[model samples]
Target: MKFTFFTALILLFAPLTSYSLSQISNPNYDPELAEKLGADDYGMKSYILVILKTGENTSINKEMRSNAFVGHMKNINKLVDQKKLIVAGPFGKNNNDFRGIFILDVSSIDEANLLLETDPAIKEKYLKAELYPWYGSAALSEYLESSDKIWKVNP
Candidate 1:
């Protein structure tokens, strides 16, 4: 049997269409887990995304900068312990001058700003924090449990 262009296209898209339909009517859907994670119908929720950047206080004072960063790390751990920060990491050198990012599990930008105030880096002007509202998977924080085990040494 010879396949036409239309037949080939239909065959290529058939699986994707069925897969999409299956996902919408997922048999593994768990209502209890959705409630626990504060997930909406799409298994997603709102969060605060913070972008940390180099601040105006570019003082060459090594000791002060070092101390501020030390405090920054401690503050991150504290926030993680409190289940407020879902994700945190530094970005590689970039033209945007972006230093780092934090996906905070907070309801609003005001709340995220309040928590950032506790960070010495932001408080001391060593770093600036920019917060934005984000919508993402509700199960994002669940990966943290396994993350701790994978890291052999603390950075």
Candidate 2:
């Protein structure tokens, strides 16, 4: 009887030992913000997925892909100077699902779309861009810094 009682007591106390400092007494923990923050600094970073849909089973050659990349880089550089794009690059592997990915700090989806629409690659049917809102630990900090300006640019 005593052994069974002790076993139950041990089990009850075991969970308490596993919690670290982060799990307790974090007054800065904002439930709303915490839920939004992802593993990456997604909140401060806007994720754009560029899907290249040329045609059915039509693969873009290396030279064409390289040209498309150059076009994207040129436009992305412009946006970056305008404080829109943060980072842009093609996915390391050719997964065929997406042509590339870009991280930006734009105000809204419409703004992002507008910028994307101007890309030669998109205009030439080389790619289509999809924008998704992201959140992360440092996102709130970044957002606070730029609070004077609106972040959402959708119409």
Candidate 3:
């Protein structure tokens, strides 16, 4: 594990795992926040990550490409607004085949795939996606609800 400062605080304060939640008891806990954060007795959840990569069909026309990307952005915002997508962003300054990623609040890879199929970029073959199961803070799902205060945009 990367022993960062915040990670240290998480391990010390947060219930790093379901088992840890069972072991530790915090007297001062907020019920409303707990429910909002999905911290059922254990603060854990199963999430999915979708990676968007350069697909084979990159020879799209310039005009079509612009529309495709705009449509893709709109689709992403739709997913975020729907709370299916927790986090989504493009990779910058990377020469690798990687393009962008989406952290989806879905249980299974199949569910994530179904959501990704709606992307115009993926439909046009400008970007293809690969999904993998991920586990992280259940509270992360709430980030989308508050992110607008920071980003000031639907993204």
Off by over 4 Å in 2: 1-69, 94-96, 137-155
lDDT of 1 by residue, 6-58 (tens): 99999999999999777655588899999999999988999999999999898
| Cand. 2 Cα-lDDT | 0.59
The sequence of per-residue lDDT tens digits that candidate 3 reaches over residues 13-121 is: 7655656657757787777888776666767677898888998786748998888899999998899888898988889867788899999988788888888889988
Q: Which segments of candidate 1 are over 4 A away from where they belong?
A: 1-23
TM-score of each candidate structure, all chains considered together: 0.84, 0.48, 0.76
Whole-model lDDT for model 3 versus the true structure?
0.83
Q: Which ten residues in a row have the lowest lDDT in candidate 3?
A: 15-24
Writing each residue's lDDT as its tens digit, candidate 2 over 3-55 gives: 79889988997877676433655556565764554323222433443344332
Highest TM-score model number? 1
Q: Higher lDDT: candidate 2 or 3?
A: 3
Question: What does the lDDT come to for candidate 1?
Answer: 0.95
User: Given candidate 2, what's the lDDT at residue 113?
Assistant: 83
Flag clash pairs in model 2.
43-135, 43-136, 107-151, 107-153, 108-153
**Ranking by TM-score, best first?**
1, 3, 2
Q: Candidate 1 — which pairs collide?
A: none
